[model samples]
Target: MKIVVQNLKTGKVFLADAPKPAVPDNGILVRTSASLISAGTDRAVVGLARKSTVGKALARPDLVRRVLRKVKNDGLWSAYKAVQNVIAEPKTLGYSLVGEVLAIGHRVEGVAVGDRVACAGAGHANHAEVAAIPSNLFVSVPQGVADEDAAYVTLGAIAMHGLRQANQQLGATVLVVGLGLVGQIMLQLCRAAGLKVIGLDLEEAKLDLARKNGVLIAAKPDDPGLAAKVAAATDGYGVDAVLLCAGSKDSGAPFEDVAGHCRDRARVVVVGDVKMDIPRNAYFKKELEILQSRSYGPGRYDPDYEERGRDYPIGYVRWTERRNMKAFMDLLASGALDMQVLTTHRFPVERAAEAYDLVIGKTPTFTVGIVLTYGPGEAEEYKPAPKARRKVPGKVGLGIIGAGNFAKGVLVPAMTGTGGFDVRGVVSARGLSAQAMKERIGAQYSDSDPGRVFDDADVDAVVIATRHDSHARYVV
Candidate 1:
């Protein structure tokens, strides 16, 4: 399988061939048809990866502190190797993908093989040929929703979760800042919830897009009469709630600006990455409430809920991440949310690097929701490369299941340095990582399916370097 990956150390993006991943007992293997490129989130990650080591350290002081703590607890060589592994590995990108279930684990239910579903989460739903997704992070895609549109389900769940945090009622007026992909989705959801929606952004084109999509009142953050516009839209009471969906390094100005436009005791929900330097006086005087919306919903980042498939009680937790995804798909099926208008570009998965260039504004055109398409036959069963005619004797044949940072920067280097191991193959959920590892180690084969490694007669040992939640399953 072929997938896109970014080198954290150099920020160079490229394609690689990897093995198909093994499905966990509570997960399913998906053959991706389409994946959504999140401009804000993914661009931020790429930009950080492109920065110098010092720049990265400065940007994430907390991470530096954590490294320091590791050095204090562990020896310097161990700490150094850890940091090296952290930056040297290639990272697979994309969190929103729609595909068919090629196979299901023994414990998986509700979704069967050949079922069309939308997957969420970071590593589990990456922009790869095949992804091993936890059962709770995916939802069945309705027949009416196209694969391209269904790819937006994860982002839609994010917007829906942010709205849920606001807890607004019908006929209330809400202000959605940003007007980007997530903000645009929030605007449509607000309208569907019967709230009068006002959209704001720095780009006139985005504001225009929002207006075309049922946002009657839209304005730029710098508009001198912005407060007055909100006042007029809300009959002088200002907006009942503010959804801050904008991504900025410093959110002080936007928050301060919106403070004057919010009614007394109004709620503010931040759905994007931004510095939250709230003005004490404004929030104190207005008695405003500020809340932060995590990605998706309640079950997000909970391993027991997502990986182990232990669902939350519906009575106590009405909307888990999976339920939110389902709701978004339901809206798509009911025609309440139209994702087609938000999509501006589509590229084949082979041209994924160019797609990222578009997202980063290297291209001459603009895009809001970019979808990466895959051919019908792109998800065929894995086939190992032909074996070498002559093989080295007495070398321990090794196959690694993940080619991520730890595997690439630490394990592979150590194995090759020892001069006693022959790396037969490298397998990663993303093909790019597998391909990169194969090139780095001069391995015979790289694949997206780990089963190839296990089945190989030459492979005497297997290494698992995946996430902690996946380690046990891989080990077993």
Candidate 2:
């Protein structure tokens, strides 16, 4: 299948052909129809990935420390090779996608083949032609919700998780910082829950979007009367909670502003990328509580819950990531959340690079929910054709899955220089990558299905250059 990947060393985005991922025992194989680009998070990752090694190390000193520890414990040569391997591999992007179930594993239940579902999580619900998503991360999309709108389910879940962290009651006023896509959804969700919502952002266009979506009180962070506006909105007590949903290079100013607007003993929930430099005096005097909202909810980053499909009991954990997705889908079905107004742009999967450009501000456009649409006939089961045997003497037939950075930069280049190996086929999850690699390598065929490589009779050996999590599955 075709997948979108970015070169960590160069930050160049491209498509690659990868073998079709196997359906796990506790998962379903989804044929992707639409996936939403999380502008804030996606841009941040892309930006960081594009930076130089030194810049990256400076930006993430914790990761540098980990690398240094590895060098200390292990040999420097091993650490160097490990870092080289990681940088050489192309990283797959995207987390939220809506698709139809092409197949299901034996342990999968509640969802079946042909079910229209929204999938979440970083690697599980990637921006690829097909994804092997655990049952817990897949939520059935209601008939009323369109696939394009359903793509927003993950982002909504993120916002929902942050709102839940605040734990504010009805009629309590809450301030939402950064009115981007997540913040906009958060504003609507807060309104649905009967909480008074006030929005703050640097972008007037986003603030305008919030106002159109029924958020009455909105202001810029630089406004001199911002504190007064929050005071008036909350009847002089200030906001009961502040949900910081904006991403900033330096979050000190935003943190200070949020602190200034917050009421005494109020809660501040951080959902976006912001510096956590809290002012001791302000926090001490107000006795405010600071909480960080994990990506989705309780099950986030828990292998037992997400991967093993073990759900938390309802009595203890009210909302897992799956429940958050369901709640967002329910809101969309019930017309409580206005996804239509929030969806500002749509791009075909072929032009995904251009879509990223727009999100990163290369194209000066106001966008909220940018959806990537796939071509028709993507939901069908794949069947690989039998490969013809190599007729040339002393030549070995080669079929490769995952034509990303490692395949193109190292593997393919090495194979090309080798004497007897013939490049028979190249497959990627992304059509662009498959086609690009095929043309560059002079391969006989290029496909989006990995089964093609496995079934080819001419192919003497198969190469797996995909992500670490997929290595074992591809080998099998």
TM-score of 2: 0.84
Error of 1 at 327 (Å): 0.6
- Residue 451 in model 1: shift from native, Å? 5.6
lDDT of 2 by residue, 128-150 (tens): 88888887998999998999989
Give the top-scoring candidate (TM-score): 1
Residues 333-449 of candidate 1: C-alpha lDDT, one tens digit per residue? 999999999999999999999999987777867679999998775425545457653336899888888877767766778878999988888887646667766876788887767
Residue 51 shift from truth in candidate 1, angstroms: 1.2
Model 1 spans with C-alpha error above 4 angstroms: 382-384, 398-416, 426-438, 446-476
Q: Which candidate gets the maximum lDDT versus the true structure?
A: 1
